[model samples]
Target chain A: MKLFQDKISSAASRVRIALALKGLDVEREAIGILGPDALNRKPEYLQLNPQGLVPALLTDEGVLLTQSLAIIEYLDERYPEPPLLPGKLEDRAFARTVALAIAADIHPLLPPRVTAHLGMIGVKAEDIAEWSRHWIRVGLTAVEELLARRQTGQYVAGDAPSMADICLFPQAINAERAGLPLDQWPRIAAVVARLREIPAFADNGPAPRS
Target chain B: MKLFQDKISSAASRVRIALALKGLDVEREAIGILGPDALNRKPEYLQLNPQGLVPALLTDEGVLLTQSLAIIEYLDERYPEPPLLPGKLEDRAFARTVALAIAADIHPLLPPRVTAHLGMIGVKAEDIAEWSRHWIRVGLTAVEELLARRQTGQYVAGDAPSMADICLFPQAINAERAGLPLDQWPRIAAVVARLREIPAFADNGPAPRS
Candidate 1:
């Protein structure tokens, strides 16, 4: 079993946190996703993950899993100890909503926004950042409302650290790094503060972009 | 089960197709996501889906499920006869690779690109369209490569339709509606052609923007 790629990938970090929670150990190979090493570009790596994305988890059964949510869900399904998803079906969906709010909505917008920042081509950095903030604000505002509905708790989904917390912590870090202020969403700020206190989260930390 | 207000919502359409596949009857309410139906504006819808996106499925148990992929997966899990995800665990992951390529990569860029075309905002329409095309082209190119590697009959995974096909068919219809060209990816084009013949896909159709 192997987790191929780097410490800096949001997707990779997600797997790491989940695996730690499950107490499962897989061989870790920190291959560079970009540049000369470009593990994602290698024929063998591409075979494992055709999309050429990072944090591709090769399961003990030798099945390579792409997409953070899918991989995480598979792990939770296979290993029930210290479950990541909530117990009830509705609660599970709610956790998924919080997770997707960041994974699908906030995560995708970051790259183009950053690419625009490089200004290597004609795309303006400010425009990209503006686009990034627009989506982040939209998603985070919704997350704030979600957290508000749940009683004052330790994580995004009630007291326990569920998939919602796992998905959100990294995105919150990324949003902070992107210079998007969280002053507007106090509930989210509270959640982030709580998540930061966890040892696993602090250990995984945010990746330093190349 | 009721599908919350959406006269013309692609997400809603996708779920409608899932229900049809299961032969389950569901009542529909057109809350009009973009209009002043107030469902999307009210706290109720916000509670259901923090993203404020359309096609929030109100289950028989009254749980509101959001995020089309997540909702669809739930449906597939519940109704296993006409499976959405097919083949072994590895093959299922491959199918998810195709699904994410459309859902996360291609779909996210569409709204901004389409709005960019309207020229109502100051942001360059051409730039937005270029960004849309760039992401779509990259996604489709990957799909094309995946197909080139293994395609048994008409469908993506094997002879039968899977979640990957379900996701791709809808997006293909959407891209065509948006006037995006498909000459570049023949394998994808072929798959789309084959999927259109399926009853489940044909009946749901693309939701028209009201």
Candidate 2:
């Protein structure tokens, strides 16, 4: 497999973590999503991924996959040894619920393109920061509350790290980066700390954007 | 099964379509997400769903499911006569990719909370409309291009209305609501027209916000 990704993309980070958890090796191609030579804007990359986003995976069968959650799900299904999703139907739903809470509700609001759009719309930088922090706080607080209500083990869903934890780690990093520390959500902070102990999650921390 | 939802919620509409497709019936409870009498803001509703989002499902097994996609997946698993996802792994991934492109990327930007935040930050109503239209255009155009590249048969993924179509219908409605017509994406418009013929998709169209 060949993966097209940017270092700082949280979505891509999720896929990278999944690959590592699956113990699979793939050729990595770094794509610039920022600056003058942004590869995601290039015609070739756009042709491969119409969304022109980072973290597209080309399977050995030559199928091109976009959308990080979809790619991670593909990986989990294709390589099912250490499944990213839980075995039980209800547990899996809970895991995905937590994942979507971050992916759909929180992370989308704070991406570079979104903040840049806010800037273009004449939103002050401070307000944009506040906007990012506000969603992060609201979303993460909900996740923390959800976790508190559940009988959580080491991870978001159960004893093992599942899709929920995969989604959580990146957004927690996003929170810290946005100046909203994980201290606000102690359960999330503890779960993230446990995730950091794993090499797959630890090694794939978001790299500095070039 | 019991579902907590609002008539105008696109997310809830996705679940409604899924349930209808599966030929299942659920008890529905109306929850206001907007205005002063918003049920989602009430202590009881928030206790039930910390995210305070619509389309939460309580299953026969007494499991509480949040997140529309997750709930749909659970329903598909627990009642598998007709799967919402495609059979093949790659095809299933593609279906989910299309779903998340809208679920995680486009729809999040147009929700009432998001637009309200923009307004609170002093964006004019016209600008907010443009903002909604801008994301709808960009995201749906990408879906159009993706469908154009594939051998789509009546739907976004295939002849069957999978998860992809479930997501597309509501978002296309959103595009129309934002004053951006579907004439811009012929393929999506065609698919949506076909989806409208199905009572599952047609009847669950975002009801007028009460």
Candidate 3:
């Protein structure tokens, strides 16, 4: 099994944290998603992941799978020793739903493609950053409200960090990087702080964007 | 089971198709996601789903679940006889990856929040529409490339429609509704045409945006 990842990728980092939490070892290669190597844009890489996105996991069966959530869920299902999803059906649904809040709603908006589009349309870099800040704050605010509910505990789901925490931690790092203050959401700040201390989540720290 | 959905919601339409495919008899409540009813914005609705998004499904166990894809996956998992995901682990991952290309990459940008943000910044309606069209086309182009690969069958994955088809069909409808042309991606257009002919996907047609 092998995983092609760019350390700086928000989606790739989610996979790294989940792998660490699961204590699963696989061959890892850091490929540039957008720079000189830009391996992700190559035809060969595109053959594996047609979307040309970072973090494509080739399972033991040799099937190349794209999508961070899908790959992480695959890992969890394959290696059940430390399941990332809750055992109870409802709890599992909750974990996944909140995870989607970040993965689906927030992260996609801040990718290079969107930023590049903003630039092409004459949006200044600072203005682009402002745009990022706005979307990140709005998405995180939704997460904060969800976390304020009784369902969120030490982690985003139960005592343990499930898919919810795995997905949220990277985005929280992104929020901080984008200069969006987290003070507005104390509950989220608390959860992120706790998550950062975990060896699994911390081992694959967010790589500074070059 | 009860589902709170908006007729015009792309995400909600995904669940509607999936539920119909599973043949689950779910009680439906049509809530305005944008107008005065904007049930998703109400405090009571927020209590049920902190994200305040449409298509929140309350399970028989009374657990409220959000995120259209998550809700559909839950339905698929619970009702496994006619699985929305492939039986093979690898196949399931592929289906999910293509599905995320739409759910994560495409759908979020066209949501009211993003468009509303554009308007807040003095972006004209035409500019916003152009922005939405550009993103949708880029995302669909990626999907089209993936579908062009030999791996894709009659549907996005196999002959029968899986999660990938279910998610892609709704977004294709949205693209067309938004005045984006699909001729550029013949493979995707063909698959979408086949999917729309299916009873499950056809039952919930796209409602004109108010």
Task: Give lDDT per model, in order.
Answer: 0.70, 0.88, 0.82
lDDT of 1 by residue, B1-210 (tens): 787646455656677777777777778766545544444456765656665676778788866777777677777766677787765666677777667767666676565323442243354656555655666677778778767765556788777777778778777776666567666688788887877787888888667664
True contacts kept of each: 0.35, 0.89, 0.65
Q: How many backbone clashes does every candidate have?
A: 5, 0, 0
Model 2: lDDT of residue A89:
93
**Top model by lDDT, which number?**
2
Which segments of candidate 3 are over 4 A away from where they belong? A34-44, A150-152, B35-43, B150-152
Which pairs of residues collide in model 3? none
* lDDT for each residue of candidate 2 in A68-93, tens digit (9 for 90 to 100): 89998999889997999889898999
**Residue range with the least summed lDDT across 10 consecutive positions in model 3 chain A:** A33-42
Model 2 lDDT, residue A43, Cα: 85
How much is A87 displaced in model 2, in angstroms?
0.9
Q: Estimate each model's TM-score.
A: 0.85, 0.97, 0.92
The residue pairs that clash in candidate 1, if any, are B5-B29, B5-B30, B5-B31, B6-B31, B84-B163
| Superior by lDDT: candidate 2 or candidate 3 | 2
| Lowest lDDT 10-residue stretch of candidate 1 chain B | B112-121
